[model samples]
Target: MNMMSYAIVSVKNNSDKLNALLMGMKGVVGCDLFAVSYDDIYTVVSNVKGANLIADKINALTFAGVIDTLAQQFTLLPVRFGSLMGSADAIVKMLERNRHEILQNLLKVENKYEFGLKVFCDSGKLMEELRLKSGAGEKMHLKPSPEIKNSVYRDYLDKKLAEHRLEESMLAYVDAVITEIAGRLEHLGAVNNFKKMVSEALIIDAVFLLERDKKAELIQVVKDLQRQNAGLRFILTGPWPPYNFVDLDIK
Candidate 1:
């Protein structure tokens, strides 16, 4: 039978403890919990037939919940969903092959947690705000010369130019916001990954990895950022298992 696997957890010197933990917990969708080990690292997995795999929500929030439970008790590298091996022995061999990388990753995130932040805004409203702000500057001079003629072609070109300028201004505004956020996070000394303009609504999508103790402070910071930017919405989720911060890929 095939299996639906989630992660390779680092048991370190507590392999027996990990085994005990797995013995009590159930896998997703009624699968049996089992482990495949290589010295210190253990892949906590469950058997699943290929047809049954469809029942598992590949990146669903439930998967994160399971990973979260495990992370609370051990250091782990979260595997992307659909990471399946034929059998427990195959998983063990994979862990053995990637032992060094796994250990390094475990050390890196041993006591840390990950948080996801998404900033969203009404793009049209924001664009209007930007236009109002930009309008304070002197207007560009377009004398009624041949180049400034209001022909159909000229009108189309001008519309496109205005759109291009608005886009540029929007990007610059988003960058400024990101810079401000990063500066604030700097005080906490956290590691962050940020992506700008992920969608029309999501202006800033960022993830931060920091000491588990910093959760409250991070929440306050995000609250403050939201207050400072009334036009945007900030959604913060986690204290996750460093899923986004993992740097190792199994060989």
Candidate 2:
């Protein structure tokens, strides 16, 4: 059976506790969990036929649970799900080659928690509200008058231009909200990433890595942001391992 890896962790002097935790926890499909180490780093792994691993919700959640359990006591770089190799010796050699990148990644996530913030809004309602606020429905001077120009092509261009302008206005509104969020979280020394307009209703998908001690403050910030942006819905989730923050290439 091949070894399916879960996460690369900084175990250091905590091997016993790591082992004890693994003993009580379950890996994918009732398989036993163990660690393969190089220097102070360890990769949590389980034995299973590589072909047997399926892409399903159950397996994904099980893999995340293992990383979640380990993150409680140690700083770690979460390995991608379904990462497998031939044997423990193969894993060890892989670790040896990638040791520098792994340690650097571990250090980046040490003593931190990753938090997610999603801002949602009714797209139609929000755009209308912003239009009313900005007087955007007012006629623009840039549009060529059909009576003066007498061209069907110009009318079509005008319609497309109006649509483009409305989309930009919507994005501008979202950016304003994101700016305020960054300002508030600035003092907490969080590193943040953002994606805008993920769906019709979801305005923003954001994640940040903050010092672990700032959970209370982070909650308060989200609460205050929710209160401030009455038109938009803000949902915050996590104290999770740095899943989104890991950036490394195994050599």
Candidate 3:
């Protein structure tokens, strides 16, 4: 049987508590949950038939569900969903090999939670607004000077220039929004990761690692941002284990 690892948990002296909790839980494909410990940290795992490990939505959710349940009571670094090893001895060797990095990541996320925020926009409408504000719209439609009006090359250049300007304007707008988000989260001491222009409709996709006690403040802050950027839709989710904050190297 292959062992599927769900998370690396900081059990400290609560191994018994963790063991009892796992006794009531099931892992992917209804496998019994168990732990393989080294010192104070443990990797929660379960027996998985080599043939039963399929990468499908149901199995993925079940894997995540176990991690989520464990996170509620412990500070843990969620292992990638499909992590597997041949045996318990192999897992113990892994724990010994990566002890320093594992403990360091666990300490970093000890009392923090991860939150996700996505900002959606109407691309056409946003571009139009930018053009109007910057007077680019009027300039694009202006009649060319008599000397260049009939020159095909000049007309083509003008069109390309307008497109270039619009692209720059869009990038600047996205940067401004990201700046505001980072500024607001700064006071709360959040560690954030931002990706801009993920798609035409999804302008911003970001995640933050913040203290558990600051969840409420983060919600209000997001609400204020939504109000400020009425043209964009902001959707926020989480309070989950610090999924984005974990830095573990498993080879």
Candidate 4:
């Protein structure tokens, strides 16, 4: 059976506590969970046939549940769902090889939780609003100059120019929102990452990692942003494990 790794935990000197914790928990499909330790770190894992680790929803949830349970008791770097090593020895070697990176990442995420924010808008409505605000609407609606009014090439160029301006305006609007979010989160001392304009409707996808105690402030900040941007919808989720903040890649 291959070992399916769940999380790399910092147990420090309390390996026994981590061991006892794993002893009481079962992994996906009733696989008994165990820890492979090196120095002060432990990788929680379970044995399974390589062929049985399906990527279905049940398996995914179960895998996440294991990590969540462990996170409740320890500061861990949550491994991606399908991470596996050929054997316990390989896992040990992996832990050894990646020890420095592992410790650094674990320290970064220690006592922190990741929260996600998605900003959505009705693309047509938002675009129209932006065009109106930027006076692009009036320009697009204006009759062409007499010299170019009947020229198809000039008409096409004008249409393309208007579209380009619209696109730029939309990007600028998204960037402004991102800046405001970063500013608000800065005071909370949270680290944030943002993706702008994921789709026409989804304007912003952002994640923040902050101390566990800062969740309330984060939620309130999102609320203020939502109130201020009535044209867009904001959705905030999680005080979850730092899935997006982990910076380690195991060998």
Candidate 5:
């Protein structure tokens, strides 16, 4: 039978404990589960036949839920969906090949948890506000007046200038938000990675790796931020295994 593999959960060199954890747990679509190990790291896997390999939203969510459940019990590196190996022996050899790097990554995230923060805003509304704010500033010098014969050139320049100013304003607004978040997290001593303008509506896509005990504090921080910025929506997902923080790419 084909196998559907998930990730390598850390066991601290105890295979029996890892096996026991996998015993009753279900994987994507309630498949039968088993494990493949290399020293302290174990990849929990399940059987997948012909029709099961096709990607489905429910299957993906179920797989993620499985990983989340396992993460509550042990340190693990969540493998990307559809990651598979031939057999238990193949997984063991793969782990053995990438042992040092895997351990290093495991140690990096040992007792920490990961949180994803996605900040959304009404782009059209926000941009309109930004344009009004920018317009209030000093106007740029116009070399050629719009009333002149080459008014088309002037119009083009004006449009381009407005576009540039809008981009700058958006970036500035994003920076201010990031700065506020950083300041709050600094007080809590959290480590974070942030990306701005991931999508038009999603202005900030960020992840934080923090002590598991500080989950409540982090949630409060996000709530406070949302309260302070009524125009933006903060959607926080996780307490996850450090999927975003893992720094290794095993060959």
Candidate 6:
């Protein structure tokens, strides 16, 4: 029998507690869940026939659901969705090999919540605004004599220049936003990772791991940022399972 790993929990003298928790929950494909422990660390996993398991979204969500329920009662390093081993012994051996790293990750995420913030915009409107600004710049720089407006090459160059300037402006704007968010989260002592310009509709995708008790304050701070950043919509989600903060390698 194979085992699908859900999370690496800091069981730390609490295996019985984790066991009872798993009894009331389900794992991928609604399989009964169990734990493989080594000292203070536990990997929550479920029995699955190697041939029967389908690594699809449904199973992934089922795996995540189990992790979610486990997270409510423990601080865990959420294993990647499709992680599987040939047996419970394999998981234990893997844990024994990577024990130090896993324990360190668990300690890092203890009592911390992971929050996601996405910054989105309507690209068309933003482009028009940039065009108007660039047009204003062109007029100020042109000679006093009225220049011909219809040179095809010049028009193309001007458009390209405007696009370049617009991108630079957007990048600068994103930098300022990142600075602002960092300043706001400084007090919370959050560890964050950010990706800018993920897509036109999704300009910024960021996640922060911070003290769990500050959830309300984090929301308020983001609300404040939303009000300050005009034309950009911010969506904040989670207290999640330290999904983005777990930094570990199973050696």
TM-scores for the candidates: 0.90, 0.93, 0.94, 0.93, 0.90, 0.91
* Per-residue accuracy of model 1 over 200-231 as CA lDDT, tens digit each: 89999999988888889999999999999999
Q: Candidate 4 — which residues are off by over 4 angstroms?
A: 136-150
Question: C-alpha displacement of 119 in model 3, angstroms?
Answer: 0.5
What lDDT does candidate 6 reach at residue 39?
A: 72
Backbone clash total, candidate 6 = 0
Pairs with steric clashes in candidate 4:
none
For model 3 the TM-score comes to 0.94
Worst 10 residues of 5 by lDDT: 137-146
In model 5, how large is the Cα lDDT of residue 180? Answer: 95
Top of the candidates by lDDT: 3
Give the runs in model 6 whose Cα sits over 4 Å from its true position.
141-150
Q: Rank the candidates by lDDT, best first.
A: 3, 4, 2, 5, 6, 1
TM-score of 4: 0.93
CA lDDT for candidate 3: 0.92
> Tens digits of per-residue lDDT for model 6 on 89-150?
78778889998888788889998889999999887787677667677776676433246556
Whichever of 1 and 6 has more lDDT, that candidate is: 6
Winning candidate number (TM-score): 3
Give the distance in Å from residue 5's predicted Cα in candidate 6 to where it truly belongs.
Answer: 0.7
Total colliding residue pairs, candidate 4: 0
Each model's C-alpha lDDT? 0.82, 0.88, 0.92, 0.89, 0.85, 0.85
| Residue range with the least summed lDDT across 10 consecutive positions in model 1 | 136-145
RMSD of 6: 2.6
As for candidate 3, its clashing pairs are none
Worst window of 10 by summed lDDT in candidate 2: 134-143
How high is the lDDT of residue 230 in model 1? 94
Off by over 4 Å in 5: 140-149
